[model samples]
Target chain A: MSHPTSTTNKTLAHPLNAWYVAGWDYELTRKPLARTIANRPLALFRTEDGRPVALADACWHRLAPLSMGKTLGRDEIQCPYHGITYNSAGRCTSMPAQETINPSATVPSFPIVDRYRFAWVWLGDPEKADPALIPDMHQMSSPEWAGDGETIYAPCNYQLVLDNLMDLTHEEFVHASSIGQEELSASDFKVTHDDRTVTVARWMFDIEAPPFWLKNMRDKFPGFEGRVDRWQIIHFEAPSTIRIDVGVAKAGTGAADGDRSQGVNGYVMNTISPETDKTCHYFWAFMRNYCLDSQLITTQLRNGVHGVFGEDEAMLKAQQEAIDANPDYEFYSLNIDAGGMWVRRLIERMLEAEGRLAATQEPQPARVGA
Target chain B: MAANSSTVWQRGRVVELRDVARDIRRVVIEPESPVRAAPGTHVDIAVVVNGEQDVRSYSVVESDDDGTRLALSVFRTPTSRGGSVFMHGLGEGAEVELTQPLQNFPLRVGAARYIILAGGIGVTAVLGMARVLARLGADYRFVYAGRSREAMAYLDELIDEHGDRIEVHVDAEGTPLDVPSLVGGLGRDTELYMCGPIRLMDAVRRAWQDFGLDLPNLRYETFGNSGWFDPEEFVVRIPRLGLETVVPKDRSMLEALEAAGADPMFDCRKGECGLCEVEVLELTGDIDHRDVFYSQRQQEASAKMCCCVSRVVTPAATGSRERKPVISIELS
Candidate 1:
């Protein structure tokens, strides 16, 4: 391997075989919504019967963007240009001036499933699009947890977001005013990975809780004033999804041994979808097991995480700009990169299986006529 | 450039060495720190040749998951400056200095399809890439070309691993590789990566152009030492610095200049990065543009040369130690 000093990690392509959230369930409805997942433009909408549908945004007739068109009848979209209509399955339903419809007048219909409050779309092989493979975001809809989240249209590669989530040490610096703490940088962590998942577990015992965690702890255990046991267990699912188990409890309550009854536990659910080579749709939620009925806590937690992640968003954007400037610089990994490395290895495997990955990620411009 | 002026070299020791094929030896080294190498990664090793330390680059043929161990295959070329000979002479437990594995030839993940072509010793470059694709169940074709069956290293292993996806073209069989046929068979979406002799690379490039394939889709890594002309003694003079040095047949111009205390900016000594490039002020002989850093048009213009792997050659000199062609250049 020749490490070029000027290489950028932004050129890594996204894997398409996995399902990515196209939009929140509420975001897709009678009116068609335009979205790009894994570089494939799509028109997302719901049929009159309330079934989620995703179709290639381009119309079959003149390649017009169907997303600009209006919904009509039961489950069809009328192309804004030339009155072409396509059903939810992307089959041309009717032609304005022609009697016989060309059998080939059909757009690609992606397999879309509505689950966990999201419209998940698969842009790769339709046959392999299995809903079971969707990452486990049960916390989003489960009765045991209550929370809210917002979407961040991050202006950086999806992998960068995943790396941010996989390693929490960055929080110490990037979110110094909120969740950042010296214990985070001083603590040792463990990283483990399998074929489809990676887990990074870190624990800080008998340490002062960070401001964000302190507020959450007070919400559960009022007037708590002693050292606490804090933990951040990052779980990564292949392609791009991460669920971070986080919270703090009283120092000597046996929380480390799975008795979380003395702790305030929260799940930071994140799933990123690449919209292009350098941008992504970051969908994240902060679910808490202790406050299952309080709407106030849900909004407050969402707003707090939002602010913490805003810091990350700024850093990610700056990192991306630096990468763009030095297009040939390669990244140097530290000891903390174990979990992120596994994530990249898994992604590289998926890309290789799709025959889209080379051993080296050299950013070659799209050649003319290619 | 100043940040990269100083390189950090770590101590390593040879753990094992064995002949894998004709003139090809596989040497395994354990560096002080664990090394994880991606496919198409190579390392720069400081080899002591004739009591003087010189740097040489070699691709990592394989590595364990933990990266504590790495294996590199070297072909002993009688004309090689010194890297291969020094490596061939090393015994188990021999101490050496090497840089961390670096990747200049990374395989971009996520293409529609791929065709991996390797020629003779060039197999060392793409072997890891082939294994990765095979492990991932990617849609790919592996083509290996060699002068004879015995000369092809890891032939049996590749055939066993890739099964029918492996295609071998042994020149001894009197049926050489057909570049046009190969290029014609490629799908428009297929990316082809090749590493081989200069003749083979030239044929492939010509065929790719004739077929009107995508230029960027045809990626390749060239041997820095294999040029249009054989190695010969050359004289390099920098008028601005009042420096003149003789680059012997066994030494590269970059190394010779550095030995003479001429500070030059260089990275990826394999002629991939144009950093070590110098402006051709004057030439008393023809320049062999061996580096892949320049385009064919740039090489033909005769305005510069990558001193790391390129040199000046006299038209009438062949195996003549007395012939020293002088080339005046300005460090860029």
Candidate 2:
């Protein structure tokens, strides 16, 4: 039995605004790439000038994905199931099965852009996109050369990871045998958090680094005994996402200019995306002031990050299982964990900004700058 | 005269082809428009090689709901020059001109028992009829016969789903088809329809007649001359309209008439696609029910020619009048 309500309810909100990474450029060079955005399957493609476009995955005629289709002599995606070809704007271009080519037909297409070397898609309203207002990335481009960048998909919400990354103290326990040690903030180093994102930065000066296997500084310097310089930066962007940056600044002579350059400063920015309420994906890009060739800078950084991600996945999975077992495990919030509270506030504010926030929940507008 | 009009739409190139069996093929057609054909409606598929409309009529073996796409299984006739040449050249998505559907073969509408018989690739037509029958929730018996099992297309689909109601006949060494025994098996209420090479149809007709049984309406579709498209039957002239033309006797009466000059409006062509069919300005013909598409009443009142199938049966112009014709011209 169907209710005789208004018929306009068929179309719903497309989770847009903020930045949504569509896919890698190399993979979908000539063919349409098939993926799901905002809980619906979509095909991402390009026009001749490299402008990216996304459309509903299935063809309106046969319900076959446009991605499985081929481009006709004219610019468009054709369903492989049937030869029904559609244009960039999701309009049917022609029915090859017919005797004549139809010039007027179409399908629904999503708005997309390629900026900062990433294919960012607008899953919601096209009218709201402002190119001038893209996500901020201060540590990218040319030399102070950024390290290799890589990506990984997580089977959980992008929010949870943002919260986890913001609460970096977890690495001490979660990554105990890997990147973190329990001695991180034992003596009240410092912590900062408000709205937007949390930053736990402090001068780790003149202190022996964690272990004998932590990359370049596995062993401590006699002159710089228990000493090194490091600073951490992290950002949480909307709809559903998080960004984490960790950098190391040098205190002495520099190899970069041979004229006492400012030592080594490294940065790792994590871009997390919420594919669904329970699934998330992250794109991690690394940058370093120290010199490294394209091969080592590219290949090794990806491998190393992937290895670290493998560990995080196992821990996240187990943690999710525990949460599933107990629906009502109320836990108290701590001052040091201020980053997590802000991440939730950001999600709520983004939802509200898009008119998607629930009426039952009061709007907790997170204070912007931290 | 509102159903059968003879007009030829576009024809396409033979693009893709594959041999599904020893002589059967899966021919995919890339049409020029959305065909939205029902399952049972047959399309006139004309393939030209070396430049001739070597036309072969085949029922759509399968059709999508919108009638935009269709699939047919044609059993290649190796002996016929036009037939063999056309079949061997078919490739995937090749262009083929198809007339809008001319649905001449129709099952008795409503919930009636349908008995379908296919002789060989005669199965193509009934195969479509069976599908519509299933969709309509009507009970049916599909009697598929061939020289042997290999000749039958999609034999497995029938065997898998309708095995209980299906009957197979072949001129085998050991087992034979008990025709009388098979006919003797049906109850009086069943509607029987048979399509195949002449012999099998003859056998079924004889058997059913011998029993003096209540037979279902028996029908058949035979190939017509290319004149099916010629509308000129005689030198026609719209006196006041200044229209004078010769309408061929062989083409659809309306087309020939229209061409020579009398434009008779029609509607459907199975005596159904009647874009040019119209009321009687003058009527004549056996009014053959060869077109199973229309009802008895519609056919009667309309005095329809289904110009695709109907022809003029002139009275005085019968064989003798044109012997000495030297009539002068005087027009409006």
Candidate 3:
């Protein structure tokens, strides 16, 4: 199979017509919050009625960032530079100094919805926005699961982060002190895909528990001295949602089958939204089914995952810097990049299809003589 | 009568087909060209059934903006005449004709709250509405009912996606829907939309009226050719074509015209698309407005009617009546 060389290019465009996590629900308050996605600045906040809204951060008049402004009434955002107040739909509602406000005076508003404790924004045509495409991360909010989440700004390209998550072999060397184990790199794995999703699954039979798992599972299972069944299932939902299901169970407990109750199950939701060419917003949560009400386990898992991500951040940032220094060099893909490569191909196909549509939809030029 | 002049037909290829439920097949198609469709809209698919071109409407389960792909979940009922069976018999890579998405049962955004009622395969019609409402952060509840869990399409997916917001009632499971209680418990300023079998819709309509809810807020769309009046044979006169045809109780006006060799441009025989509409020059009886395409005022005026679904009803035969309702119309 032939691979597109452009996939390795650093200037690849991010797919826009898809839902991306802007921030957690708790992060947005009455105050405007600024975030950059796909190199576009966005101002996000909730109205008095608790409806989340996102708009272009730049004012339509003087190009001042709206995140620096204050909210007026129940749903209008007032620009600090000119006192131009806009409603939740991004239409300019009032202008303090002008006698007649221009009807065209408005900023681009994005389609936003709150679900699973996260505010998701559609950075595409509002008319075509469909919430069904949003990845199912309900486990984070379900009563049967307990977990904590965190958002970190990584100084690296979003694709680098995706690549890192898609291939967990690095964990053996990078996260050896915590959740890493040799079985992760040594075990055989399989890659599968449907029309809209890609999954990478790996199972290590009768393997020793890693440090983090041992620390958490020792209390739950006191007789956990022998080998156990461990599995890692990573799912990539287009365009940029990654969920990793990692857990272990007693030897020969049928955990590999549909019976997950025989094992301890936890989910790692890693949602990547591009901030710019060299930065991204990483919203992540760790949910476990075994300890639904244990605050201690939640905190421990949160800190442990946070530290593990920090190690990835350091490595990715350094990698980005090196790639920047050698801008003309093209990166090569390995056998383990199958999952990440599939995601890249899907994004490219969508982008190409959109481009073709726009080309055809462009107004035809009038006949020269007619 | 002249055929509908505004219908735009496009070619689509069936790419995938899988049974999601006992008799429900999730059909995914790739159109010849990309077409954009909003949530709560449907497209008319044209299939050759028994050596004749037949058109039927199916709700769009999902579609992208570029329209590169469209997905529809269709259920084959035992009472189905031929449309559902013809669609089910289609294999992968079979190219068929379809019209652009048409919106007859549109979701009215900005309501204080939304209540969606879906019965059996009718869930396909309101599934997109729920998705859009969820994305808008609007308060909404989805109540879906069917004979059994095994016969319901998208039940598992809907529950997985919407969680507590969805309430599923399976009759075989002893969970029957309480229409009165459900309608009575609705909050003020809420709008209710339903799409289902005639019985379910009629029950909801009656309960809604009993509860004193705003009649305009209770919107609905029927499956196919379903109406309150029992099917009866009638005669249609086309002044321009100088043709008169007898529409049998089992056939629609459009079908009768086609059988009489009078071409009628039409799409979405389900009565959603305004194509195949005809101007009513004279009417000798009351009209049964089965189609949801026309407003109440338009239906009352009796000026025009969608030939695909709407029909005329003569005054009840009284004192040995032998003549049927005669509707003189011209193709619009």
Pick the winner on lDDT between candidates 2 and 3: 3
Q: Over the stretch B1-332, how does candidate 2's per-residue lDDT look in tens digits?
A: 32345444666444446565558886655456546555456777676757777656678777665555566677768665575567666656556677766666554332136678887778877776676565544578878777767777777887776767777776643444666876777765456766788777788788888887533234455443222222224343344455555445455545655565544555434442333443333333223333433455665664543454554433343544342211111221
lDDT of each: 0.84, 0.56, 0.80
Q: Is 1 or 2 the stronger prediction by TM-score?
A: 1
Tens digits of lDDT, candidate 2, A170-232: 767766665665445552434455544445554444334443223533211224333444444
TM value for model 2: 0.47
- Give per-residue CA lDDT, model 3, range B104-143, as digits (tens): 5767554567898899988888998888887767789999
Which 10 consecutive positions of candidate 2 chain B have the poorest summed lDDT? B323-332
The TM-score ranking, best first, is 3, 1, 2
Cα RMSD (angstroms) for every candidate in the order listed: 18.9, 23.5, 15.5
Give the Cα-based TM-score of candidate 3 against the true structure: 0.55
Give the winner by DockQ.
3
Candidate 3, residue A142: Cα displacement in angstroms equals 0.7
> lDDT tens string, model 1, B1-332?
11123345798999999898999999999989866777787878999888998888899999887678989999998798888999999999999899888765666443457899999998998998888777656678999999998889999999999999999999999867999999999876577878888899899999999998755567775323378878888899999999999999888899999998999989767675577989999998888887766767788888888898888998655535465789999996
Off by over 4 Å in 2: A1-15, A97-105, A138-143, A187-203, A211-214, A217-226, A239-243, A249-262, A292-294, A359-370, B1-332
Q: Rank the candidates by lDDT, best first.
A: 1, 3, 2
lDDT of 1 by residue, A130-242 (tens): 57788999999999999999999999999889888999999888899999999998999999999899999999999998889889999998997888999999999988999
